[model samples]
Target: MPTFTALTTLVGKDSAEKLGEAMERLTPEPTGVGVFEIEDGSGLWEVGGYFTESPDAAGLAVLAAAFDAKPFVVSELPETDWVAKVKRELAPVKAGRFFVYGSHDADKVPVGSEPLLIEAAMAFGTGHHGTTLGCLKALDRIAGEGFHGRSVADIGCGTAVLAMGAARIWPETVLASDIDEVAVEVAEANVSANGLTGQVRCVEAAGFGHPDLAAKAPFDLVFANILKAPLVDLAPEMGANIQAGGFAILSGILNEQADEVVAAYDAAGFDVHTREEIGEWTTLTLCHR
Candidate 1:
């Protein structure tokens, strides 16, 4: 196994709390990767993590080379090869009947069930983050009740996990969209990998700005797992897109932020049904009024 080094800087103890909060929000896993923090004499601090893999060397080199051009006194940690390390932890993850795999060349989706292989990027909703898991649980809850063959939309469809989940749960078709083209690409790939390419379609859209966004009108089911601020900003449009008595799932909220998120939708005329929590994250289910 090859071992590569990583470096992280900190801006003093004063920034520790904020940095810690950011880390928690980011939730960078430290297995195939490990993170450590460093403090400079001037109170500035740097935190870094390393990947341990031989195959990942090329990718890591590209990342390291890019950092070399900058003169922020970037510290270089001991070299570690991480290809094998990441691969070991990147094993296929099975959740219920759905299968989630990494993006490496060795990343292969299971033949049975639904296979969703996503590039292991820094983006959330690779079906590994807590928010993603909460959304998945919320999805499972909605799936138990069934889709009633109604249309659905997965807003902020990072990797289109929930959308794919909906497609797998019911034969009903779903439209998934994301603001990031990269995420959309990953989502499209995942949809095809899962054999639900025909059922769940991915598109690029900034919020509800997609040209085809309005065409899916008054969807019977809507799932939006985004941050609190955007969730509040989208309240009006969310109300407009969901049909009366239809269901909507909202996630990407912290425990303390749940009520605020629920209030946003409540004011928009959604009646709260249930709020699901996993770890520090929360997912709320509501019915359009």
Candidate 2:
């Protein structure tokens, strides 16, 4: 089956969302509509729709004009076996004490490093990305500084690689949560694949909203490898959920956005302990004050 996508960008979230709603009502209705901020400090929001068949170009044109957005660029996506393609393209990544590899690369695990199996499919957070890599490095640094987590949580834990990394070193049961249900399922599968079924608990939650996460509050450490806006929105709750003198390892931020994120967390009662830039992303370790 062929798949088609129509993409456009607008200035405001309200316009993007309204355009998404309008896309849903088009003939040959979109299978899915997604609206998201561009996140590059562009101040633009993107509205994209996926369709099983070719979309109505005229309808898209009208919506774009109505929303004051860029003209929709429609494209047909090739049907490719993404899993095999990813396996062929993504080499195993080494970040600090962690060696993250796909099952296909099992033979490459280094002797003394912590190994985490993350098959590249359906979810995010392979340690190859700078954000994930930086978080792993931060965790390693914290461990080297003689801190061990009593209880930890990874918010927006896509594949639970970070949680698994923490579990590999510490005695704590790491709770991994994500807003997407499919991501939770992926995390669970990765946990099992890593033989970490009892060590990492997976839940579907936005931030710390899940009761299981809330009950495990005042965590000794927390990892949130999600983007800027959510991290900022999560600051107050992060302050409340982390124990006094506990730590937070945060990533998924562009280097340019790190200062704003730091200010937000500082207002929420955290003091930046360390800052590391990997490629274009910045990872921060902060202590709750």
Candidate 3:
């Protein structure tokens, strides 16, 4: 079936969320509505809705005018198999010893390389993105230096790819957590797919808030591939959770934002061990002092 969408942009988060709630009450009501901040430093938030039937343009216009938002743009989206498209576009990624690929590329697993199967899904971190790729490489580098992670935690774990990567090399159970429940479910599925059901534990938590994670504190290594704001905010917590002389691999930072993140971690008693830049992203490996 063809899908239709109505999208509008507004100035503030509050207004955008209110507009999204209003869209839910429209005739032939939207199947789903979402409000997201546009991260271009524009202070703009995007409100959008998807529908199986054509959206009511008049209703959207009325809501836009009432909320002082831009005029809604309605469009009919062609029916397409998104999974097949993603499988076609996302080739396998190789970062040091780790190889990340979907089931379609199962035949391409190179011998002697640590294989990590991550099927395309609603969750993130397939290792194709620079942030994930860089983290994988940093993990490999740390292992190459003869560091064995007795306890590892992957904060904001998406598909649990990094957690699986750590599990592949070490015998200890790796903890993977994400704030989104759906992501935790997806991480569990990925862990099972990689035959890591017992090796990686998945949890739903923000940062280190979960009881299970708190019980497993002072990790020898931690992975937090989240944005700069949360990474900075979690600096003190990260320092507390990581053992002295342990490591933290952090990414999801723009190239220009690396220095600021480094400063935050530095103040939290971390010293930069290594830094890698991939495209527009930068990943840092920090040693807890």
Q: What are the RMSD figures for all models against the true structure?
A: 9.6, 1.5, 1.7
Regions more than 4 Å wrong, model 2 = none
Q: Which stretches of candidate 1 lie above 4 Å from their native place? A: 1-86, 90-99, 102-115, 119-123
Compute each candidate's TM-score over C-alphas.
Answer: 0.67, 0.95, 0.94
lDDT of each: 0.68, 0.93, 0.93
Order candidates by TM-score, high to low.
2, 3, 1
Q: lDDT score of model 2? A: 0.93
Ranking by lDDT: 3, 2, 1
- Candidate 2 RMSD to the correct structure: 1.5
Alpha carbon deviation, residue 248, candidate 2 (Å): 0.4
Q: Tell me the lDDT of model 3 at 47.
A: 95
Clashing pairs in 2: none
Q: 126-160 in candidate 2: lDDT tens per residue?
A: 88789999999999999999998989999999888
Question: Residues 221-240, candidate 1, lDDT per residue (tens digit)?
Answer: 88898877688889999888
Better of 1 and 2 by lDDT: 2
Best by TM-score: 2
